[model samples]
Target: MTRADYVMPSNSELEAATPPLWSIEEQRPRISAVDLFCGVGGLTHGLVQGGIRVGAGVDIDPACRYPFESNNSATFIEKDVNELSGADLLQHFAPGDLKLLAGCAPCQPFSTYSRSGRSKKRGLDWQLVLGFGQLVQELKPELVTMENVPQLADHAVFQDFLGHLDGYHVWHSVVECSAIGVPQSRRRLVLLASKLGSDGLRLDTGDYGKRTVRETISELPPIMAGEQHAGDPLHTSSTLSPLNMRRIKASRPGGTWRDWEPELRAACHRKESGASYPSVYGRMEWDAIAPTITTQCFGYGNGRFGHPEQDRAISLREAAMLQTFPADYKFVRSGEKIQFSRLGRLIGNAVPVRLGEVIAKTLTSHVKMIFG
Candidate 1:
């Protein structure tokens, strides 16, 4: 026979021809899930740790592929989700097997920062959520979950999307991350939907008093200004210019540029034009949780990014830890130098692993109640 004629079947075809790979009768039922827009695979990592098998992750950013694959042991497909079809998804997951779809699409269009001053431009970014909705309608996964900035709940398109999932019992709430033991004051809208249950889905909130900044990052080895921690790839700090070093030296923990002497203040800070922006040049307090981390977290001028006690901005590793990624999560390849911009985006965009763990645990409990 020709080699072409004898070619082996792909994994999907073999899976379909064979009996169910995992049988609930013979073993503990494992909930299978797919993560869309899976940034850095934080949710995927947590889901796997929670006993849910993550089949694959889909994202448009190529930068996310390495960390996603490296950290989660899941396949990462770099493609715009709008171009994907139901057949593509069915290849990984068998029909009639318990299916779950989880996603937290880019929220820039609905973000509070983006709304500050700009005319609304509708385009592919706006269509992302609709694309996600279409996939849900086609695949009809038994359960669905999503997380995003609470501002998204105010959008009309988001409201319509919720209405379309009429057959599924859905529960949504604007959850405070601090209230969920995340150690930050960030608030996000979380939604859970189930087609199999009439009681709807709700995540249990644990006692919120356990986690704090001191408890989370206080124990790590300290690095000085413009220094990276030894043997820690993500613990690299940004270099400060001489003038900025003076400013940083004068900066008090939890204070802003207003604390500086008149001669040391930035010109814009003294001008009426910059009166409205108060968070710039601010430092975090060691005793309290840090401010909301953003994509520009490595830059000193970006929000309240100054280090609490150090004279430099918080390092990339600190940012990741604040996002609830484990201390040793591999952000870059071994022997490769870490790039701040690449690492910053990966850290900022990730769903905090701890938060994902909480969500996955709750969903798994729900699934076990029904099918286990």
Candidate 2:
């Protein structure tokens, strides 16, 4: 399915104070999939949007259960990918249907940011990626895909993943999100492998043009720092300290904390060592692409997460939208209190739905060329 063909919540439905009741029509698609490490179902939602049927999503985080199941027509299996066997995943697919496995492993350990940190605790997380490859080797799925930080492209684990695809036609490259209609300036490594044929399938990186911050979030009703929009609870912004409030007020869009008065600048900002990290305490430019959304994006002090016009950091909903989630994609179930850290991690760690859609589209085209 194309973007125009994909259904979305109506404006009235989206504007409702609460999510609509969960319902999805039963489907028996020829192309079926199971999403591993499917945090909050961003990639699964995109697959569904691209006209693929996803049987279920697997992730260890129980917090992901609600959103993953609520937003899409798929079951949520709370299990670690490392512990899941190929047989465990195979049961979700129908016999004779094309099987697809998507695993976007946690990228923190392989991210450039993590490498710059002093901590070595995250070093072992890259091993989790190997489990995905193990499953692909055992299950011998008809198709497989993975997405991660571009830095991971050079990692040994990635080479090991390619090693698993002995009989499959594989292709991978770093895809820029702005090229695919996502509103953020994020780049990710994308891999696609197919056992269908020697047709030499490759991804199609279409020119959708750049999406800007103003184009993406300009229509939403504004809320101030520490306040939630009465109409939508998820539209709440993080409470800023008085010092941050003053600092943001002095800041201009696209400008850093250097714009602050000498008294308002953080001690770190005044220090020579802080000059390299200019993106911190910065506001996004309204008409330009947004900075990459990080897990701590709701905090104004985190990266360039400050709102272009508002005096607060972007809300969780704004971050989700920037990540290409639908306006009304429910993260928290109704009546559940929104937790900023948990929700932010789910949103930031998610594959941008637009990027996922592009991946799905590429798969769809390849499947048609091979099977039709």
Candidate 3:
């Protein structure tokens, strides 16, 4: 996104500003927000539940437009973030006096797994983060928020983003997402900032006790490999080879391929070096939080993604639920067959909606504390 020219609003201007809490409660002239890099509206849904009046979501993926619109009742624009301007967002707001802008920028660049060849591929995505900083510099919204993998907080790109907050009060932390009620183990770096000075701002952790894998998926109707739950098309599972059938059936929950008999071992696993990754070809523990659900979470061979005892890989819907999306969330149109590649990317890449809710509450409480 090209940077828009802007001047910092002075202290008198800041003091003259009305706290948005009034608009939220009176239900007229509501506080409005915009979400960038929104994927399938997971964070948007949670933000709505947290009480922000979201107006538009910007994402480059056309596939995101449907769910982002359907669930959040917000406009979804298909454009790269680098192409966006502060003016592009102004059109979406209602008659709100205060505005908030937020997003979870694409996180692959900072993910632990993607760290392998970071130097060459970092340009495009790295620019996206810089673009976000540029927008903040221009729009200077009353509030700013974002969710990304934890490693990002360590990078120079993030530090430069921090430098852009010249007069803003910022609260940031690396959070254990499971502790906040997401059913998978995800660690994310969350940043919340406000133009108001840092006096009373804080981000509180949720005390809602742990959510386990069984609590999430034990109730869904069972389906076999390559079969769709007759009632829910999204619950379809991928087919397993005859060899994989035996592999999964022999697999115990939370156990690795190390449990397999010598005859059943894949040639790769039999190699001495392959012993390093014990999580692959394993089943999830029924009573534990699931392993992090990745872009390839639906494929059993990719990780410990096998169904606990079903002798099949976890289905698409299961992966979505594990990511804290509601059971009824739709990724594709009705009567459309589920495409694992596209849909998996949507689910795996989404911010667990619960995480959004936490950010929402944090922002709400902070606003109330400072405004009142």
Candidate 4:
């Protein structure tokens, strides 16, 4: 029989595809996954899109339950990963031929913000990383995957974590997230470990064309300062102070603070240290990838988050889109007022759904090669 003629959609149209998982129509075994630290189910959604049967997701934040469950056909279990046993997680999986345990522990400790050598204490964020390895060792799932900040692989904690997998073959790389279709330029460390004695796939950046910021959000309905788009409440932008509004109006896309009029310049911008952080208060370049979308991305003062032509910061919907969340992905329950801080954390902390799809595709291919 000849192979069916099929042309995959471009990166820009990835989310528009119905049912998310683009290749499940073919013969493939059931490979279920349990997402640990599944904030708002970004990884779970993308994994589902890549054809994995995600039975459930676990996270400490109870708020994630609605969005996680609403968007994907998966249960969201509210609990600290530390409190949950691998056996408990494994129970979510059916007697499938293959099971996967996936998670991306919090990356704050290894983030550039915390790299000033200022901390004398190690918090649960670090502990969570170690705990991830512990669970993997305990459960010994046939396939394993994790995604985190690129700096994580350099940490001594990461080294010790690797030691736990004595016999598992590991394949890992520092992934340039934007290259893999995420609309923002973010780098992450991704690891795939397998007890199957074969190396798993590492996603290829060259496989697809890059998406641009304009393509991701330029079509989103406009919103004024402190106003939500009537079309979609989630498209609400943060209200700017009088001075900030003027500053954004004077700003040019991709331009820095130096481009602003002297009268609108903030006191900090005049300082020598501020030159290193030029992207703050800057408008995004429409044709390029966005700067990394952080938890505070809804604020104009955070990174280059200003709208390219509008006189306001990027809205919640825009930020989510840059993270490659589907246009219709729900972040709030019915009648729930969208909280900026909570939504920001959810969108920023999420693994870009597209990147998750890349990981899922990699895992699915390896499993099929070895099992089918």
lDDT of model 4 at residue 141?
Answer: 82
Candidate 1, 13-88: lDDT as tens digits: 4467335534536332345788999989888887777766778899999888888888786789899999997678
Evaluate all candidate structures by whole-model CA lDDT and list the values in order: 0.77, 0.84, 0.82, 0.83
Model 2 C-alpha RMSD to native: 7.9
> How well is each residue in 1-372 modelled by candidate 4, as lDDT tens digits?
002222344544445533343344644345779999999988999998987888899999988998999999888999888887888887777552367889999887777655555363347688888888888888888778889988878779889888877787788889888888898889889888877646445664546678999899988877799998777889999899999988898889999989987888888988888788888889999999999999889999988999998999989999999999999999987678989999999999999999889888888777666544
> Mind sharing the TM-score for model 3?
0.90
- Off-target runs (Cα >4 Å) in candidate 1 are 1-29, 94-97, 114-121, 198-200, 272-275
User: For candidate 4, what is the TM-score?
Assistant: 0.90
Assess every candidate by TM-score: 0.87, 0.89, 0.90, 0.90
Candidate with best TM-score? 3
Name model 3 segments beyond 4 Å from true: 1-30, 115-118
lDDT of 3 at 54: 81
Candidate 1 residue-wise lDDT at 270: 89
lDDT of 2 at 245: 92
Instruction: List candidate 2 segments past 4 Å from native.
Output: 1-29, 115-123, 198-200
Prediction RMSDs, each to the true structure: 6.7, 7.9, 5.5, 7.1
Worst 10 residues of 4 by lDDT: 1-10
Tens-digit lDDT track of model 2 for 124-234: 566678888999998888899998889888878789889989888888888888888899999888999987764536667777889999999989999999998877789
Candidate number of the best lDDT: 2
For lDDT, candidate 1 versus 4, the one ahead is 4
